[model samples]
Target: MNRHISPDGYRVDGPAGQDDETGADLPAIVGRNLRRLRTRQGHSLDRLAKLSGVSRAMLGQIETGKSAPTISLLWKVATALGVPFASLLTVEKQAGTVVLRRDRSKVLASSEGRFTSRALFPFDSERQVEFYELRVAPFHREDAHAHAPGTRENLIVAKGAIEILVGQHAPVELTEGDAILFEADVPHGYRNSSHGEAVLYLVMTYVETVG
Candidate 1:
């Protein structure tokens, strides 16, 4: 953990990662990835829409680059796909140098630009876990759908305050230097309850598929 983060201090907001070798736009990249993954899994728009809790129209929009999905929506899609959350957000391989870099990492942001997650490692079939630097804007909440069974999420608060709610349990509060780990197989979210942005290190573990 070299802590490679956004260069712009705290307000790192954007959509679906950085430019790969191709320099494609965020919508195009996400749409292409989503379409490929859905078809590979042999899921149709109607079926995937029902499974993901997103409307078939919206799914069609996302698959056609006509819309940009929020973090929550993307999470739903990934969960339905039985893959890591970054599967649809990632369009290109991260350039390697043994250590991660801000430029090399793929950063995915909410459609509203309130939440951003920067992937700290390259995704591959052999990897069972994914790590990220998460940034949440003031008063923003990113609600994520449940992951595949046996998935867990670990969060370490680096700055500001956050309220985390997993499943239907009570919301847990965390401040600077505090960490919380919980089963991510249920619905979960991160909320910035304070006026400042909440920065955290998030680790996602998957079993048999991604842990």
Candidate 2:
């Protein structure tokens, strides 16, 4: 399977669970997550260095699991990826009947790593409602694909500021403790242009009840 690596920071690896990151494989987990996020965003080590403000050499070392970064350094990289610092630390796991902690949740990132989305619901293919939390870095915009017919999305700003744009309408600006709901069948997006990070809890609901 594609770990999404290129010449700048590429590596092919086994699929999740085959050789996925676990609690014991912290460094490898971080490296794998970083590589996947970087490649999906089309970032080479050089480009990631520019984005994360970390040296390319260090970025390479992190990818190869040869180096462990300080918490501050990890923050820089997480900010660059528009994801929470905990995301890089999360371990890959199979979906379970119960998830006891957010820190242990599985994470998915934007193509550019400008946004990190944590799944809050069980990985049920038939589930109609999907819940998630999103972390976005300053000045980052995330485009979301349209969902099923009659689908709707609801969001609450847990922290910072954001602008939600649905279809051709003007963007709606929100601050801490604000909320919005809109049809998700059409195109939509979230934008965070402030100097501070934005945190949002999102709920996506489809028309039909999933079984």
Candidate 3:
């Protein structure tokens, strides 16, 4: 793999066999990268562990590759690191760069059949904005969720109807083709109040400070 630096100087390593390794080696790689990035951002392990709601021990294990993380674990770590979950893994090498078909895109289903979110890009950049396709079943409501500092969300309704509540504002109704952009810090919730399912496209942007 040819390791290069992004414009921001963060390392970007993509090549075959990066995500494949025998035994605990994978975690070690992930841990190393996580620690390096965390340090670069001036975040102590304790602070990161606290912010991510993950145990320091578990994070250590992930950094050391002693424990392979589940999807939820990955989610926590990625959220803590302020990166995308897939950013932790190395991409497989391919000749001629064959692309994976849309059917092969990884899918994340909501625990309750209420909705589904599909990631649109790899989540590895130190300061990356994420894009997702959200599907909300009829009459579904999501518990309030908040993002980190400076995180912002832009949601566009593609089909059906959606009701969004941000902070103290009254729930706003959105029909197909309508869009709203807002800061994500305040508690927020979403509901599909229409008779049919609703489809929404969401963009999540992360803000980072560099000295």
Best by lDDT: 1
RMSD of each: 6.1, 11.8, 8.6
Q: Is candidate 1 or candidate 3 better by TM-score?
A: 1
Kindly indicate the candidate among 1 and 2 with the higher lDDT. Answer: 1
Worst 10 residues of 2 by lDDT: 6-15
Which should have the higher TM-score, number 2 or number 3? 3
lDDT of 1: 0.75
**Against the hidden true structure, what lDDT does model 2 obtain?**
0.69
The digit string of per-residue lDDT tens for model 3 on 47-77 reads 9889888788977876775665544555566
TM-score of each: 0.73, 0.55, 0.67
Task: Show model 1 residue runs off by greater than 4 Å.
Answer: 1-22, 94-107, 110-114, 122-127, 137-142, 193-196, 208-211
lDDT of 2 at 107: 58
RMSD of 2: 11.8
Clashes of 1: 4
User: Which candidate number maximizes TM-score?
Assistant: 1
Q: Can you write out model 2's per-residue Cα lDDT over 113-203, one digit (the tens) per residue?
A: 5677776754323345668888999989877655445777899999999999999999999999999999976778899968998999998
